[model samples]
Target: MLGMPVTSFGWSVNLIVYLIEEFNIKSIAAAQITNIVNGCLSMLPVVAAILANSFFGNTPVISVSALISLLGIVLLTLISFFDNLRPRPCETGSILCNSPSKLQFGILCAALALVTTGSAGTRVTLASAGANQYEKRKDQGSFFNWYVLTVNIGAIISATAIVYTQDNVSWKLGFGLCAAANLISAIVFISGKRFYKHEKPMGSPFTSLLCVLVASMVKRKAVISSKEEDYHNRGIGKEAKPSVSMPSKSFRFLNRAALKTEGDKKPDVDSIKNIWSLCSVQEVEDCKSVLQLLPLSLAIIFVTTPIVTQSSFMVLQALVTDRGLGPHFKVPAASVQVISIISSCIFIIMNNWIVYPLYHKLTHKPLTPLQKVGIGHVFIVVSMAVSAVVEAKRLRTVENEDHMSVLWLFLPLVVVGIGEAFQSPANTDFFYGEFPESLRNTATSLISLVFGISFYLSTALIDLIQRTTKWLPDDINHGRVDNVYWVLVIVGVLNFGYFLACSWLYRYRNLQGDNEQDPKDIIT
Candidate 1:
């Protein structure tokens, strides 16, 4: 996972600069393109997760995806190497620079699509795979913490070292290095194939979920019986038994699917029963589990929106800021985002080594996933508030000077990073733990879904801001960019409230059996 990000972030983190410099794209257009690509990168993971769960399993999916990523980066490296593959560099203050040719643009888009798809495919599946290696839920949770830490470490390197290389050194060399890293990752993953505990694909679990929904709809008029024997037991062994005594009372309408109807078989023999009129108890419960998780997942999208927006725009902000370290050294505009990555890495370690242990020691219990997610939501709100203040300060300082120091951007990013450290792993842990075991891969991919949706929403939000007001003009310095941060602060607060409500109402299903920690021990 770490090695894969070296290439993934290498290309993505500094993409705005690449578009501006190599493709001669405008800043706003570049930002919009980045958002769209980022959105696709995030959203595609769901498809990848499904593929992993239904057909190829985790290890194979990750290996193939990593290989595809390498090919994509190699294409990108070639693009950097050949001047004809991209437009000529735009002169400073030149608005009339040549756009990329159709072929150049097509190849660029294809490469990006491939890389994004590959990266997204591996990102979450690897988490599922890693967690699957451990039987204990606590060990799985620890693995998730370290998984995030490793990701941030890779991101730090990409945002700083790879970004710096792309900026100062030859773009070809930088992208070549990314391609090499991706190759190494693929090789390493392939080499470890023997050691991996492979989970066999159970055909398509989604089919059963859809079947349950369809069966419930078909049996809508049927009365739900309280008897345990009313539910169908389709298969032999443990799967045929009820995961719970009854379908959840929350979504009572869905209970009709499991109702023993006239045509339904007592022993569920090979006899023909209308497929849409009958479902096993487990199928109904699986659908309910997903239904329960959907709200929390949707709420998380808003929490991530501001952070995604911050990272994207922070690059543009750094471009106009005083990025100099000394007379001889200069910070790359994209490299400024590394502060958040580094901070996240630090906080992940602290949370694992200090925070969790200390909480356990004091309360005789560990922090629950929802508690961590709530804490994360709080930090994001605080981060947005800090961002608003810092942007206001930067604007004030910009009034007197051409640019303020880029270092000022670090505070809000660090706050956001710490918040992510709390929330991100916990979010994954919560979903993975609470979701039906059959949908484990999908559960792990939920974070990516949040990111994907949030980025697209952020793009729309930015477009809305630009269209409605002058807060985000082509040249942000002339507009009230601080107001943008303020808007995010408001959104963040409201979203945090929404998250609290969702977390409060949510009931854990599978987590109780895995972790010995009491549900009442949650900090929030």
Candidate 2:
């Protein structure tokens, strides 16, 4: 999983620069392409996870995705190598350059689409697969922490080393390296097949969920029974009789699906007749779990959208700022974002070893995932405020001088990195533990969905801000970019309130009591 990111990020991190410099695209157009690619990569994980959970399973999905990614990288390498594949370079100071031909543009989009789709497959499902390798919940939590750490490490290396190679060396050579890395990742992952604890694909849960919704709505007039005996059990083979004493009070309308009507079938091994009148208690519960989680997931989207917008804005800020690290060494504007990645890597380790352990020692109990997420929210708010302050200072300084030093942006990046350390792992652990057992892979994939939505939302926010206010003018020197960060601060605070309410109402389905028990040793 880590290896594939290195391969993918190599090209993806420097994509905006590649489009602007090599393809002769405008800055705004290049940024838009970056946003689209980022959104697709983040969003497609849910689709990939569903496929993994319902049909193919994680290892096959990840291996196949890696192969597809390699093909995309190979295509990208071809574009880099063949001058004919790109638009002609413009004269030194020309206001406009030749646009890419339709053929070139089509090929580029196809390559990007393939890479983004393949990336989505590996990103979330791999985390679920890793969690599956361990039986203990604590072990699973540890794996998730390391999972985030590896992601940050991969991102940092790609954002810095791979980006530098692309910018300074040959673009073909850089893309060639990405292809090689992806090939190696595929080989390494496949080689571990015999040792891996592969989860078999369960038939689509979405179908069952949809059935529950349809059945509940269709039989809304039916009287809901509180008796355990009234609900269909279908106690067959591994599916034991449900121990849920009664249906949950929340989403009371959905309880009607499990309510036995006159025509409702008993716990038969054969089949269920009326889809609208009959559903297993377990099925109804699974649907309820999703409904319960939806609000929490939706609330985080607002928090993340601002972060995504800030990331892109930060890169632009770096470009205009003085990026010199020393007398000779100058930081690439793209690479400056690695500050956040590096901080995330460092803080994830600290969060797992120091913060979590310290809290446990002090309280005689481990911090809950919701608590961790709340702490992350606080850090995110602080990060936004810092960003606003820094941007305001930068704006003031740049008015009198050529540029402000990029080093000033590090505080906000580091702050947000710390926030991510708390929130990201917490969100993953929460979803992985709280979601229905059958949908664990899909649960983990929700994190990616949050990010994906945030990226798309960020693009929309940017457009809206540009249209409404003078905060995001074409040039930063003329705009109050600080005001944009202030707006995000307000949004973060409001979203945090929504998160608190949802978190208070939610009951953990898998994390607390159920997961704390010790499992019997596997006979390996």
Candidate 3:
């Protein structure tokens, strides 16, 4: 939780600056590279989660991942400490600047690959592993909430301390600090091995979904027979409609999971829990809920795209805008993004203690996770609109031959941080609470997957804007960035409608037997 994100985000927070300044990469190319790197980082967790659930257990994967991460960080530090490991320093905007040689690029790519693989292994796996230590869903939810908080705290430290060091002191010292953190955290994790709960590995939840589909197809005729008998008998038949129960009736065909068989064993200590056989109602509901969660997840991806895109642009804005704080100090542009992290932390605490509690007190009910996500949608729209306004003002300042204060960028980013506090933890709670025990590991990885998709999509969107429109020139000041923000504002509006439709139709799954059910028949 603590060490892994610190290492990854240490590079992530200032990666564009590092690429642009150190390797002489173009500004837009640097941003695309950063997004691509992060997208891959965000994605590898799903693979790691599948491995943890289906094959190698969490401990071995995490243990190996930590060592790999340590090595990658060490390599990156070497690149920073030794000038010969990277391209020599180049003049700003010089046409004669040398590009990195193939060997230098290869070494950088290898180090990054190791880091991404290692970091992905630990992230969501550790969340599930920690949550597994708890039997109660409430306790599990609390653990995951704190898991997210811990990650954000690591990001905050990375963006503030590590970024400041990278910008103001030396990249060598900064990257060395990241390597040290990775090593220390790995030692701490390994030392606590004996105390950790080692759950029996369940087969992948994804396979469970497939089995559900197969089961339904095999029993597709059963549903037809039941309906026919009830119709012919005029409601007096023994099979009379099968009177749907715990799993609900929306996908009644899928309820084939609980269908009785001639050779079925009693719901007992053994046989009935077999993964390859008929399943219980609880397992049936689990698969259905996962299906139900799909649209909401897709809605989230689209709603969040604009915000993710703006986040990259904000760093670029800070770079060009005035960062001077006083006669002697200037704020590091990378550190400017930390405003979102700080505000997210503050709002997380506030929602836990203040906002949510106050709402519950006044309304006599707790705010739902869906509502929290909706609030995030509204705030991000406002943030984009605010960014557009701010950018327009900045462009005017540029036109008038003055540098706009970087402080002008603060308000929208703070709003973005506030929106994150609403969206992300609630997202975690929603999936963790609603998803069945068998799929918990996969559930925890959902947010990471969403980021993976959005980062990739956002990069593509940025490229399209750069190519088809005149909005994203190398010199952002000379481009129509405000227009880009406006386009994002429109995107936010359209996605909110889709989100609302999904929310309006979505049903909360029953959680009564979630923790107790054997997940043998489960799929993620």
Candidate 4:
């Protein structure tokens, strides 16, 4: 939920800035409204996560979030309608005049934020949660691959169609379309409840642990009581004699010798009795089993962050590049995302169909999640290098007063998309596979939290660059975004190197085996 909004917010924030400049709104007011909207909207995932883990359970939580998203879509459409209906102050010789009440603008911003909260918070998280309903870890990987594919599909279609419609037709139509799409998504999710695993919320983990401990203690006590009863029935009462109350002389001597060798203090009778109890067996093993994956999960999060930069910094760079298709036509700035979508689709097809088959045939070895992630890092490095080259070419073109074709930018997008396909699916697979069944949703949320943090970091980096550099000077094409692209290239290279080091360190680490029941039968 959080990560999707981070991507959507990137576009929406830029869109808000564009509206402010185009409509001559006060910059302070515009920024305030955008920030308010983003702040509220960003909280949805946390809300969804809480609700899913507390009361609603995964299915109901997902359904509610989807419905909320649909409402948000409708609200955005309303905002666009109102904007269109308002009289143009520019045409009335009041270009600098305040027309729409600031209160009205504030209300609209609030509504936008509300819509985002539902769409971002509920919809995104639920979709991922739904994917976890899969039975086997291998199936979980397949499910996540499809989940990532669906998201890119949405981005691709939205970028191509929404950007074109907003630019050429009407912003109202563009927003209305998204709203309608949300409604459709809501319906689809609601219908799928019967097919999803119906695991109820487990409540607080601390409380659950306490309950388990208490239950084990009770079981231990019951067993000890039964043993005492058995001894009494056998007429071996404690008052009868010390030897009668205990065991054979040889056994007593062995026990005394063992206790003496371990410590000088005599072992307690209750402690010895408790040693024969079986209640602690499962509990201790369970705790150890879950703890085994902590290091692996942390490592996965570290590697996952750089891939997330694609939607943030990379999209921002694409907006500034010269994309004139011909003399009369210019490429829609947001449509550049379609290149990644196409590239991702192609890579997915090729990886499943040709690449994996060829590798299996040649080596007679199946690809492991770690190996896949390692390959993904290699592609990430290559993608960044390709981006650097593209940026370098663009820089030269801008300096020489020459026009570069929009087709040139496609090269980098394609490279990045291929890299994304290589890494994202593999990363998702690795995280899901290594986690225990009980922690699936929590584990997924943790992965998403890392992604969210990465995006915030990227956004902060961009803002810092803008503030510190002369890149955004008043007359420099509204702040030379080219510098931003260069910065991304440098960051991407560093991320690639970091991931390589981590992958190397993790090469010999053992992954947790899959133990969860398959989701298929549970759902059916």
Candidate 5:
């Protein structure tokens, strides 16, 4: 966990600087490219998880991905080593710059592709793999909290040490360290092979979902039936009676998918024969579970979009702001996120060790995942508001020909970290607990999935803002970045309300059975 993020962030956290200085790319263009890379890093985990849960098991997929990461980072190291691999340096403050050749650009793209793939794959699979080692819910929950801590710790090292080295030392040395970290992570994962409790591939639950949709549409006119014997149990063996969950009454139209007509007369014993026409009762319920999560998921997209957008923009804000720390050390612009990481780390530790335990004892009720997530929402709104206020102050300072300390960026970023502390692990626990066991790896990757969509949307939002308003430009000194933050403040506030509606309407699923309707609305 530690080595992977260290290596991943070691290169990526400083990517904007690398592109602008080394590749001679424009600043705004560089930020977009970085967003695209981060988007890929967020997106690919779903694919990896689907593969892990459907085809190959976790270990095999992860083992191969780690090697891919090592290979990719090594390739990046080589690019840094060879002058021919990059373009000539652009003159400082000059509009015109040397554009990278096709060869240089291609190698860089290939390297990033590999690194993003490796990083995303390793993160999701390793998370699922770690949690799988523990059978008890408490143990799994603890594993998740610690998993987040380790990832943040790794990021802290990359954001601080690696970023500082890249800024003051050399890119070659910084990238070399990243490659070495990847190698060490691979070695450690391989060495721990015998201890893991491996789960076999469950085949694609998504396929079953598809089958449910198609079968229901095909039989949309069929009369709904409540008979337990009428619904197919294809998930069970032909002889064994699978008496678990009958077709659910909610989304009663979908119940047609499991209801048997002439297609059930002599159902082939070999397989779910022509599963498009008939599905198991379990499959119907699984489809409903995913549907039930839609509103909550959509609400979080707003939550995630603002946070990610703010994060990307903060780097740009750092570039324009005075970054001095002590007399000797000026913090790297890319390292600005370290504040957020540290804040998150602190909150996660306190939440796990002190806050949660203390709250449970005092209130006689443990904190539910929904409550934790709500707390995160409150913090995110505050963070965005603070961000806009700080940016406005910085702009005024810059306009007056006075300097604003980089420390001013600290408040919003710190709130961001605290929000992450609550929302991230809480979301992990919620999805992992609620999603069907067959989709365990996929459940773990849903947070990554949210990030993926959020980053892509944020990229679009940035593009839209750049095109329509004089908010983000090649030189932020001339742009109204505070306006951009103001827009996000609106987004965060609106989304917080959306999330509240979703939480109030949502009822916690009874995971124990597919049929039982024990609805527990968001825990007060």
Candidate 6:
């Protein structure tokens, strides 16, 4: 529901402009309010994620959020239907010209925020929860691949369907359809709960890992070398003092004293073995290994953020492009996302069917997650460079009073989608492989946090540039968006360099193999 409205809003920017012209209202003021609504809504995912991790868990959170989103969609539909009854000038015949009272608009904003909060929670929790189910099964690798595939399926469907609805009907219908879809998803989820594995909130895994590492450090420090002398000692060996031996007594008396009582049997061999293992120095090193890697994993999140912006920002760019296919047919601007979706599907097929198998056959090495991530970065950089060229062409086109072909935009989008298909799946695999079982959910959340923060940062940068730059024109088509594209180019290049650094750093580090014993299992 939230995504559909957001997509529609991007398409309807021109519609908002038309509303201003028709209603003779302060356009900038309305635009500001809308921007605030969008930004605040975007933050819903973070809040939802926290709630899923801390309190409600996935099922209840997703269910409740879907219902709330449905209500919000209903409200929007009502607002649309009642447009003619509201007081407003109608010069351009825009839907928003049916100027509902400021109070009505405020209510709409409130409802949208409510929808956002619910959608955000659902988005954050659902995928992880699905993945968690796979962990209970032994052959989880294939399950996870399917999980990622399913997400893409939903995204592809939503992008196409919502855009089609908005173009063919109205924004209200598009949003209402999304709300209905979410409600159905909620019902299906509830029905399937018994078939799935449920997860309990384990208090922050990062904290737990840190605690174990600190304890290990303390234990290591407390160990005193038997060979080292104390400050008071000058030449004496610490544990080599000579002692006189005189004992010659029989042990029969001690054997009588050591006879077992009713409660005492042979000592449990397994328990003694466990205690011995826990006290070993190797165990301490294992804990330290986990501690050392977590921060590094956190660092990877920042690098992963830009990959996602392909979908978010690309959708925004498509809105301003002219998309007439022929004399009587015009593609909806938002429908350009279908290119990315199709490209992603193709990429997945090529990788799974050809690329990975060919690589394994030629090199006799299974594809490593880091290697996959590195490859993903290469694609992302290429995509960004392609985008920069397109933007530059667009700039030139504007200067010469010529329109650039929409196909130019499609090329970069396709490249970026392929990059995402590689990066997202590899990133998910990396998290699962790198983190211990106890910390899987938390690790997943950290991944989500990286994505969330990246989007927040990207938007902030976009808004900052738009507000600060005198080069940008007040009109949409006439603006210096090329500069923004160039900035994205720089960011993408930096991301590629960062990934290379990470790959080099990771190569020297010892990673645990899939069959390696967990520290907790080894100790206990």
Rank the candidate models, highest lDDT first.
5, 1, 2, 3, 6, 4
Q: Is candidate 1 or candidate 3 better by TM-score?
A: 1
Residue-by-residue lDDT tens digits, candidate 6, 1-524:
23433422332322333234323444334344434444444446556655666665767776787677667656655655665423466656554445657786576566666665655556546666777766432244445555566656666665566656756676667666666676666677678778877777644434434433443333342333322121011112463223212111221121111122233234342343222212223222223445545554544554544544444445445555566778986666556767776687778778877998898789665566667766776777777777767877876876788777677789888887787678767676666556555445444555555665565565566557767885344444566555666676677676666556555554212233442322221100
Scanning candidate 4 in windows of ten residues, the lowest lDDT window is 515-524
How does candidate 2 score on lDDT? 0.83
Lowest lDDT block of 10, candidate 3: 227-236
Instruction: Look at candidate 5 and give me any clashing residue pairs.
Output: none
Model 4: residue 294 alpha-carbon error in angstroms: 6.4
Task: Give the runs in model 5 whose Cα sits over 4 Å from its true position.
Answer: 236-243, 267-269, 272-274, 510-519
Q: Highest TM-score, which number? A: 1
Q: Which has the better lDDT: candidate 2, or candidate 6?
A: 2
lDDT per residue (tens digit) for residues 1-524 in model 2: 67888986787778877888888876655766788799999989999899999999999999899888888889999999899999998989987789999999999998888888887889998899999999877788889999888888888888988887887778898888888888988999999999999988987879889889988987899888767877765444555534464678888899888787776655454464566567777788889999888998998888888777778778878878898878987888788778888888888888877988897789676777877888888898889999999999998888788688999999999999989988999889888987777799999999899888888888888788878988777677789888989999999999988888887777776665544422221111
TM match of model 3 to true structure? 0.89
lDDT values for all models = 0.85, 0.83, 0.80, 0.53, 0.86, 0.54
Instruction: Quote each prediction's TM-score.
Output: 0.96, 0.95, 0.89, 0.70, 0.95, 0.72
Residue-wise lDDT of candidate 5 within 452-471, one digit each (tens)? 89988998998999899888
- The alpha-carbon deviation from the true structure for residue 143 of candidate 3, after best TM-score superposition, in angstroms, is 2.8
Prediction 5 global C-alpha lDDT: 0.86
Model 4 spans with C-alpha error above 4 angstroms? 1-47, 84-105, 122-133, 206-321, 326-329, 472-490, 504-524
lDDT of 1 at 29: 82
